[model samples]
Target: MEWSVTNLACRRGQLRILEGVTFEVAAGEALILRGPNGAGKTTLLRCLAGLTPPLEGQINAPEDTIAYAAHADGLKAQLSVAENLAFWAAVFESDRAHAVETAIATFDLETLRDRRAGALSAGQKRRLSLARMVVTGRPIWVMDEPTVSLDVENVARFARAVEAHLARGGSALIATHIDLGLPTARVLDISPFTKLSGRQTDDPFEEAFE
Candidate 1:
């Protein structure tokens, strides 16, 4: 899959989040979106994921070809780990048992498989959310702050999983302050575009702070 954005912009109230964020990601390639807090990284990711519309410009991709994982785990706080996965799988019409099993093993959630999602710690919850994405197995992954609150060991596992995904010809666009441990990944900074008015300005995000 290939994703292309030209002059893409987003706004939050009167604040300009992303502007002219022209970029592209092809299959098996990883692109990192790096910037400070409130630099429009999350907004850009949301736009790319089609969860939120870009006020101006365009973001083009295949239908149902993208999977998005935001900073929030997006888990139903009331459900058990297994129940949550099962629910999502059924909702998405995915292979429930296989998806849940793989996610449990990948995130080391075997012990917590039957535990309630609300009872898991922050890191565990994040792992659960990430595992949901892995199970979905979409071609393009757009993640915002995927490594947040993860310990060193979990972070290493997360990076390896990402490598494995790329090896399989999948693509990812990640926004994070942490390093993703990919040698060929390119980092783009969206800070320069923050000055643009509204979310639709024509200032393309700069390539910086790799």
Candidate 2:
């Protein structure tokens, strides 16, 4: 599936988070949304996922075709790893035994399948949230800081999972300060679009603290 955002703008209360943001993404292509804090990366991702609507613009996407993994792990924490996958499998897609098992193994969660999500460490919870994407099997993924708390090994694993998804013709829009190893990604810097006049600048992060 193909997704497009044209002159998208969003506001939270009186604050304008994003404005005049335009971009397009197609299957097998990934775009990295990069910028300093408060650059609206997560806000833009939320707009694309339909969690929040844009003030003035157009987003062409399939209904619920996008899977979103926010900064919060979004896991029940009370539910076991297997149970969490089961619940999402039932909610987002069909309740298929094989699919859940495949996702568990794909994210390397088999060892902690029966463990409660709350019992898992920060990194494992991130992995569990990512595994939800595998269960949904959707064409578009909007992930916000997906690699947070992950170590070197799991970060590599997450990169491989992204590669496999892209190889299978899926599209992704990832908002991150850390790299996800995308070699051919087009970078979109949303900092310039901020409505905060004092901070507006042509360069993505010029004068912005690193």
Candidate 3:
């Protein structure tokens, strides 16, 4: 699926944080968001994912086409890796066992599939969170720092997973500071849009990522 954001203006509470933000992500492509912390990258992504309303502009995406992966893992601590993936697969109304099995294989979580989410290492937990994106079966993926705790090897695995996604005509909009081995991805810096207030906001929502 293809989606776009045009001339977006957004706010966090009463604070106007960004304006004139624009970008498009197409099937089999990735749009990489690059900007300093507190520059409203998270805020912009939140709006695009429909978690919050934008102050102005347009988003051209079909309802329920996007799957969001937040900075936090958003996993159940007591659930095992396979169980966590299964839970999300059910939530997204995708094929249950098939999606869960594919996610474990794609993320190399088979060995840890039965381990409790909270018991996994940091990188392992991150992998499980990312695997949830796979189980969603949504065409578009909107991720916020999806690789935070991953090491080099796992990062490579993640890159391959994304490659496979794009190969299947899936699109991704990701916010990250480090390179994820995506040479075809384009970078969009949101810094200038922070000029709405001539400075980043002190709003806790923006402060969290800063």
Candidate 4:
């Protein structure tokens, strides 16, 4: 599948944060978003994920094909790691047993499968949160700061998971400040699209790739 955004504009409340943002990610590819804080990376991802509507322009991707993972680890604190993934698999109407088992092993959560989410450490919780994304079977993963609390080892694990996903013809749009170790992923810096005080630029991409 190919994800394309053309002449995209995004806003937060009354303020417009980005405009004329355009990009495309083909199947088996990844795009890494980079920019200073408040540059609309999250807003753009939210717009693509259909969590927030674009202020203007079009996103050519089906809603059901995208899986979004935001900064918050959307996990029920009382639920066990395995239980959380199992619940998501069932919700997505996928192969619940296979999804749960695959996700557990993907994130190295097997040992912590029976432990409650609240009892896990920050890294563990982040891992579990990422595991949930796998159960959806959605091709496009929209992730925002996915490695928040992860250590070096866990970061590598996450990178491998992303690579494996791409190898399976899946695509991802990741917004993060740190390097994800994906050498082949294209970079989209959101600085040019950031809204300025008092006036909006007529052309946001004139210097976009510079």
The candidate maximizing TM-score is 3
- Report clash pairs, candidate 4: none
At residue 1, give the lDDT of candidate 1. 67
lDDT: the better of candidates 1 and 4: 4
Tell me how candidate 3 scores on lDDT: 0.88
For model 1, the superposed segments whose C-alpha errors exceed 4 Å read 196-210
Pick the winner on lDDT between candidates 1 and 2.
Answer: 2
Report how far residue 163 has shifted in candidate 1, in Å: 1.3
Question: Which pairs of residues collide in model 2?
Answer: none
TM-score of every candidate relative to the true structure: 0.88, 0.90, 0.94, 0.92
RMSD of each: 5.2, 5.2, 1.9, 5.6
lDDT tens digits, residues 5-122, model 3? 8899887666688899888888899989899877888888788888779989998898899999988899999999989999999999999999999999999998899999999999
**lDDT for each residue of candidate 1 in 36-134, tens digit (9 for 90 to 100):** 776777777777777667889987787887889976799998899988988877776788899788778878889998899999999999999998877
lDDT of 1: 0.80
| Candidate 1 residue-wise lDDT at 41 | 79
How well is each residue in 1-210 modelled by candidate 4, as lDDT tens digits? Answer: 688999998765545778999889999999999998777887788778786689899998886999999888999999999999998998888899999999999999989999999999999999999999899999999999999999999999999999999999999999888888998999999898887433444565421311
Q: What is the lDDT of residue 210 in candidate 4?
A: 17
lDDT top scorer: 3
